[model samples]
Target: MSDVDAVRLDLNNPVFQRDLHGLQKVERHAALDTLAKLRQPNWQQVYRDKGLHWEKIVSIKPPPGIAALCSVRITQTRRAVAYRDGAFIRLLAIPSDHDATYGKK
Candidate 1:
């Protein structure tokens, strides 16, 4: 697979672990499906209607110390947030509520 096909997690990040554990069955399935598509080389061409409204988190400022953050829709109510780490998308959180995904300063 090409570099664009990779998505990594900071398995060491407690927040990431916590958010993942908090997902409901359906939400978790959807998130995993999204991740699978993200692993494909042509993921950008994948349908957003199929559930990947990938977009940058622009409303709220990131918390202190974070440089930038972006998010992808996992389901209608859930979002998977991350930041670019070289060729991979390092997942940061999977917040169910839209507002929580943007985070606070």
Candidate 2:
């Protein structure tokens, strides 16, 4: 697929950077591997990939300029909070707890 059609990974958010950098060595390695795989697919392919388990996060409010929050299984035991901005999948947070990813108590 062309660059326009391929899914882009955005890791510039401070929350994402801090959370990712705080991960254990193994989880960090897995997350990076998954992110690499994410860059290889088109948007449609990513949506259809059951392994990613892409879903909308309706339990919490999104930030300003963000339309909606979404989550993807970034590792075997971790999910990340993110949103789509054009062709970019801009990751916002990777909370330690699975439910926290949805911003739940």
Candidate 3:
């Protein structure tokens, strides 16, 4: 196992805070569980399973001056959007709906 401590979460983002606050109890728990897995060194393997449904978000361009973004399954109906900031996974949002999480199509 790699160093699990390397993963970092960005809790300061207001949008991420708002999205997390909006989740129901069960959804919040699920999201937390996903976050825990992401912190693990074997996250890549964990996300390979269909249940996680991890993938990069290409349709919706990231905000100006930002690099690429990605999304990972938080629950059946929710996703956690984030971007790679060096070794950290800076979670930006946790939209409950799929379309809203990805943006307008």
lDDT of 1 by residue, 33-57 (tens): 7667675444455324355766778
Candidate 3 overall lDDT versus native: 0.76
Judging by TM-score, tell me the better candidate of 1 and 3.
3
What local distance difference test score does each model get? 0.67, 0.91, 0.76
RMSD list, candidates in order = 3.6, 1.1, 2.5
Return the TM-score for each candidate structure. Answer: 0.69, 0.93, 0.80
Error (Å) of candidate 3 at residue 82 is: 0.7
By lDDT rank, best first, the candidates go 2, 3, 1
For model 2, residues 1-105, the per-residue Cα lDDT tens digits are 677887899999999999999999999999999898788568888888898998999998888899999999999999999899999999988999998988777
For model 1, state the Cα shift of residue 36 in Å: 1.0
Query: Over the full model, what C-alpha lDDT does candidate 2 score relative to the true structure?
Result: 0.91
Residue 18, candidate 3: Cα error in Å is 1.4
**Comparing 1 and 3 by lDDT, which wins?**
3
Top candidate by lDDT: 2
Off by over 4 Å in 1: 1-12, 42-50, 62-67
